[model samples]
Target: MPIIKSKIFTKSKKTSSFFITILFILSFLLVFINKADLYIGSKIKTVSADIASPIIYFLTFPFDKSISAIQNLNSLKNISIENNKLKEEIKILKQWQSLSLKLINENKAYKELLNVNDDTFETLETARVINKAPNIFANIIQLNIGLNKNIEINSGVLNERGLIGRIINIGNVTSRVLLITDINSSIPVKTLNQDINAIISGQSDSILLKLKFIKENKMPKIGEIIVTSGNADIFPPNIAVGKIYKIEDNIYYVKPFVNFKELEFVNVITKKL
Candidate 1:
């Protein structure tokens, strides 16, 4: 009895598998028949597209979104990198703009200096300021041009703005300049409007020049333009010196046109006939 029951169970399992296979084959045949039938082919295809396409899309939706998200992340990172690079370039351009503006203003001043009236048999030699004493009281500077350039002792040194100093010591390839603001230095100056004569002298560490030799009864008015008087022959006559800044304690002071702290280049009078 037990053997018969086992055989029956095995037979039943095989029969069930055979029916499943047959059903699968029949389902495929039915689909192929519907596709081959001209009357039903279009209708069946339409139905499959409408129903199966949405089911397929739903199954793949998460994977497609993940790929799109990855692409978007890479694009954002690239944009950030490009933006930072642009910022650095803009900063450099701004610095260049500032430097260019300074040069432009300097050029305009040079044009005006060349237009000044002068009648002297002199040759101008341009030189760069190589060194300067920190103490304004010393008022000494060094130039790159020397005897080779025909630079002479007591020769007038000026720039586009006005007179800076005179060559006091000469060397083979360098020269020492004594600025007008030195204590031991003095230059004869005259007012442009009044023709009043005075001597402009420097005090230790002072930016203002002391006006001397004016009559006790005469006081120079404020804002009078002073020029070289050509008395000592150190500088040409009518060379710009400074303007009368103020008068106090029975002393008149003139402010020089050139700012000594920012001095860079100067023109040395190589010859004055």
Candidate 2:
């Protein structure tokens, strides 16, 4: 029993010594880590900095690339949106420019009409065409002005180029114009070349006007200018009607300057009877 006790005590001492040696070794390692900068400061710092730099780069490289790609994508998207808006603006600007050009040309034509000085006809009031007859054969247009604006029945309607029609029906604020192309329309016109007076009758087409009541002794030649004669109380004299384009036997055909299909504005004469 005594020897067994002795062996047990010896093993305990050995174990205790082993634990003490382990604790000392751990203490020494902690001291070495804490004092490492002071002992080999410059060398250790340089080595650690170099190793840490690459490690940090490896850790952050993917995140940096992701952020850069996101920024680039956002910039591209903004540019695409802006470009689309600019294209729309450009399209609208082009439409406005075309409209402005059309207005300018119309204004010029109106100015030319104002400069005309035909003493036989009274002053004319410029009117805008508001509506057209559904059947072009009617050859009628509705004007903005009417009886309230001194427009009366038989008042002549003329455009910048030539005589267009006569006002047949007048309302309080609107008037209906009978185009020269109306089947019922007739104007006394004289040929510029031969001074032969003839009755120009309207057809369905404004481009074509028939010269009738032409004396057998006088035959009209092609390309002769035709003008309105003041003999008709409805229409003023010397108003440009058209030029003769075709002379088939005794009948003469004239092509008018005003295109009825594209009529926009007209002048209404308010003549005193």
Candidate 3:
């Protein structure tokens, strides 16, 4: 059995060797053919670049453009937001500027009121309005000045336009003014046109003092100016009170120069006649 197996192995080895030789020859021929036809370094590099460059460009072109567009859009949005913020800031500053101008004009008006000349009402003290009475029936105002500022009871209070009121009550640091429109208020007034003496009496809020004691035939006409007579030591002569607005048969009414609703400052004449 060993002899028979040895013979079979020898016959198979020849066939196997022939097949191996053919395979080696075929592999060598393929290698030589590939080397002769194509370059390994430069040619492979050129082909790879040609293929990859187009793919890279195709993938990155739109992405780069989109990135640039996004950056430009963000810049524009930032600029728009900043511009709006600046506009708002400018608007607020303009409001403040307008307020400052108004305050300056008001101060100038107050200074001019203080410089008013009157020898009879020599002693003068300035006071700022602080508050008003609660009801329409009580025409009283609270002032920042009081006895501490040399303001006394019965002190005449007047503004730039005309006579305002009298200081009826005085505290240490505050005083109460009784407006001329109060029912209890009474002052001697004279018409500038005819120089007719009359007693001015308060009626209501809108309607100020009515000129009394004038003869029915000698009533003042509408628009005639009324002024203090100086007969009473309480008020100075020639101080403008108001202008006549209406005359009904024998009675005449005058509208005050100063608007009590808009009163801000007043001068308290502390002089004793």
Candidate 4:
């Protein structure tokens, strides 16, 4: 029994010494880490991270989750605002596209339909337009081109969009134009089909014109473009007049290609080459 007790005492002392040695080594490591340079500090940090990764993750998991939710909410709000702005932009673009479509159609490939004599008419001079003061619908408007123009009467006047009128009366200083919408104004126009030759007459005080003398067999369909027929050498051929819109009682109504309300400048067709 005495020998057994002695062996147990020896084992306990050895175990205590082993634990003390381990504690001293840990203390020395802590001190060394506190005084370590960048390289040694980085290595220690890597080892420390491996040891504390799970605890660190446990403490910050809730905060990371909250931040992600906030980011998602902000993203949703931004997406909503952006979607509204895009919708408004698309609406505005659609409106512009309608107006642009008319202009584009006039500029399109009309060569396949008719031989547009583009080089025949020479633009004489550009003149500033003076739309009658409170009456934009007034049939007569004055040109700001001062005296000394021997331009003949019935010379075609054109705006940027298309032909608007013809010079009706040339005075000493200013020239007056008979607008296309004037009741006395009439243009010989034809469609892509050469057989569909007809006359477009103004509606007195309206924006639309009347298509006259269209035979039953040569009636122009809605949306078909009409241009100057150059009949009797009065005006240049292929000058886009308007498009047929409505037909009632065998009378077809045309919408003028030229926007007269915005008439700011005009070019006078002097002569056909």
**lDDT of each residue in 6-37, candidate 1, tens digit only:** 99999999999999999999999998887679
What residue pairs are clashing in model 4?
A: none
- Per-residue C-alpha lDDT of model 2 across residues 32-86, encoded as one tens digit per residue: 9878857688888888999999999999999999999999999999999999999
Best by TM-score: 2
lDDT of each: 0.83, 0.83, 0.83, 0.79
TM-score of 1: 0.63
Pairs with backbone N, CA or C atoms under 3 Å apart (clashes), candidate 3? none
Model 3, CA-based lDDT: 0.83
Q: How many backbone clashes does candidate 4 have?
A: 0
Top model by lDDT, which number? 3
- By lDDT, the better pick of 1 and 3 is 3
lDDT of 4 by residue, 1-273 (tens): 999999999999999999999999999998877777766879889999998999989999999999999999999999999999999999999999988986675444232123323576876666777656455567888887645666678888886567788987887767899888999988888885554888888977788999886465756788898888888677888788888888888789999898776666677785566
Extract clashing residue pairs from model 1: none
User: Model 3 compared with the native: what TM-score?
Assistant: 0.64
> What does candidate 2 score in Cα RMSD to the true structure?
8.4
Name the runs in model 1 displaced over 4 angstroms: 1-87, 102-117, 134-138
RMSD of 1: 10.9
Q: What would the C-alpha RMSD of candidate 3 be, to one decimal place?
A: 8.6
- For model 2, which pairs clash? none
Error of 2 at 113 (Å): 3.2
